[model samples]
Target: MAREYLNVRVDADLKKQLQKLAKRENRTLSNLVETVLGNYAKRKSS
Candidate 1:
């Protein structure tokens, strides 16, 4: 499947923390971000 890309700026410390969290979960950083944003969107829209 094809996928689109998104680019955003975040604080350096936050970026490092996200990377660590993703590693601990054994998921790619991109996948982690997608899951997080997807959940947030679903909660807000309902």
Candidate 2:
């Protein structure tokens, strides 16, 4: 599948938290976000 970029503004605190969580999970920030969003989509569809 072709990939596209998404750009949005978020608060500094949220970004920092996400960065920390990604580090703990051994995933890049983008991968973490993609995983979370993908799971959310799956749940919503179900």
Candidate 3:
């Protein structure tokens, strides 16, 4: 799939929390966000 850049504005605290989770999961921040969004979309569609 061809990926496009997404610019989102998030709170600083949320970003830091996500960064920590990403590190623990051995994933980049972007990957973590994408995974979270994909799961959310799937659940909503279902």
Candidate 4:
């Protein structure tokens, strides 16, 4: 699939928490967020 940029606004606390988790998992925060959004879009489309 072709990739596009998405600019989203999120709460600071949530962003920090996710950033920490992403670091621990050895993944970029953008990759983590994309995984979550892709899963959500697929589930909602079904």
Alpha-carbon TM-score of each model against the true structure: 0.93, 0.90, 0.97, 0.83
Which residue segments of model 4 deviate by more than 4 Å?
none
1-46, model 3: which lDDT tens digit per residue? 9999999999999999999999999999999999999999999999
Give the Cα RMSD of candidate 4. Answer: 1.1
Q: Would you list the C-alpha lDDT of every candidate in the order shown?
A: 0.98, 0.95, 0.99, 0.94
Candidate 2 lDDT, 1-46, residue by residue in tens: 8999988788999999999999999999999999999999999999
* lDDT per residue (tens digit) for residues 1-46 in model 1: 7899999999999999999999999999999999999999999999
Task: Report the number of the highest-lDDT candidate.
Answer: 3
Query: In model 3, what is the error at residue 10, expressed in angstroms?
Result: 0.4
Error of 2 at 28 (Å): 0.5
- Model 3 — which ten-residue stretch has the worst lDDT? 1-10
- Give the backbone clash total of model 2: 0
Model 4, residue 37: what's the lDDT?
Answer: 87
lDDT of 4 by residue, 1-46 (tens): 8989999999999999999989998999999999888899999999
Error at 6, model 3, angstroms? 0.6
Better of 2 and 3 by TM-score: 3
Clashing pairs in 1: none
Which candidate do you rate higher for TM-score, 2 or 4? 2
